[model samples]
Target: MTDQPAAESTTTITLHLWLDVVCPWCYIAKRRVQAAIGLFERPHDVTLVTRSWELHPDLQPGTGGPVDHDARVPGESVAPGEQRVRIEEAAVDHEIRFEWARAVRANTFDAHRLCALALELGGPALQSAMVERCFAAHFTEGLALDDHDVLQRISAEAGLDERRVAAVLASDDYAANVRADEEAGRRLGATRVPFLVANRTASASDLQSVEDYLGVLREVVTESA
Candidate 1:
């Protein structure tokens, strides 16, 4: 369990998370964060919300060329063979799945747009489901994230209306929001995938350890508690 200073009984704690649906490490971190928060006695009060971010927003409908850019230009690595295996292993360690077949890194802007809609509708739970479905479709099933057929399946699975999602993807409903997220990330100094910020106070330099993350969180939450 985690610990923070006992509060004055009036202050409220909120945790805002920044993440992208296609980022594997961000997905892993989510689970670890969940586990750590579970250690708290009343974690329900430690609210969490996910903000949209894109790892490769410029990625075209069919992109991420091979293991090398040249190979990727010609065509993607087939289901990313060994790469897919490694991703699945990483996910299993965290009790998750990463289904993006390294070969296909489709444009995620539309997906992020839908996520913004989900955020406004149901908050974290709905978006989390959508992220999981996207990961499974991209990594395990090797489906297209931009394909209407595949996205419809994912939307339906995530409890969103397939037809509604199809329309959202086809148009630019949340395009501005997606661009805003990208701009905000840039402003926040995020230059790479898996970048994380805690309470806008502390961030790990490389791959972060939960202990260090918790330390930062505790430092911020307790000081204000």
Candidate 2:
């Protein structure tokens, strides 16, 4: 009789990000994480992807109320003028533009779909372009990305076919995938956007310090060995 042996299993850690189109911090976090990865001696082994998490799903266009202040955020309402000064000061630390005066946040479900479609069509390059567009749409152009039309234009600008992006944004062609990501986010207890997960563990991929993130990723790589 021959003895049977157990099979060995191997798996790679996938960092799943739960993001909202209007969330500016997620963009900064995005760049920081990529920078950290590049700094890693073994940057080739990590996989990164964006997941859908709308900041304002129920929001409607034209009727949505502006944030309490121009360039001032709406959490605990403050005088918009006063908030601007504070935001300007905060900008120095964040080293990113908030430009809230021009920002008009909306439902990002369609935008999320567009991103997923881009991933399917052209891999990470397409996704990278879309990410840049999304950040510009919010921070630079102050355009509403939640709108299908806006998303379509941005997608094209990112080199994605207009018709293809239109088709993807028309309905939930990739809603199931987005939903799956969201479900995974929920399972991992990501209460905020920009949640970061490494390997098979469910860790919040949201806004985190760059050094802290690098430490976590390195630990995962070491443990996997």
Q: Residue-pair clashes per candidate, as listed?
A: 8, 10
Model 2 lDDT per residue over 43-93, tens place: 676677777887777787544545443443433456647755654553455
Tell me the deviation in Å of residue 94 in model 2: 8.0
Clash list (residue pairs), candidate 1: 1-39, 65-72, 66-72, 99-138, 99-139, 99-140, 100-138, 100-139
Global lDDT of model 2: 0.68
Each model's TM-score, in the order given? Answer: 0.77, 0.80
> What range of 10 consecutive residues in model 2 has the weakest lDDT sum?
1-10
What TM-score number comes out for model 2? 0.80
Cα lDDT of model 1 by residue, 29-124, tens digit? 666566656764456656556667775666776555432212111112534345445445545756674433353666777777777777666777
Question: Residue 71 error for model 1, in Å?
Answer: 14
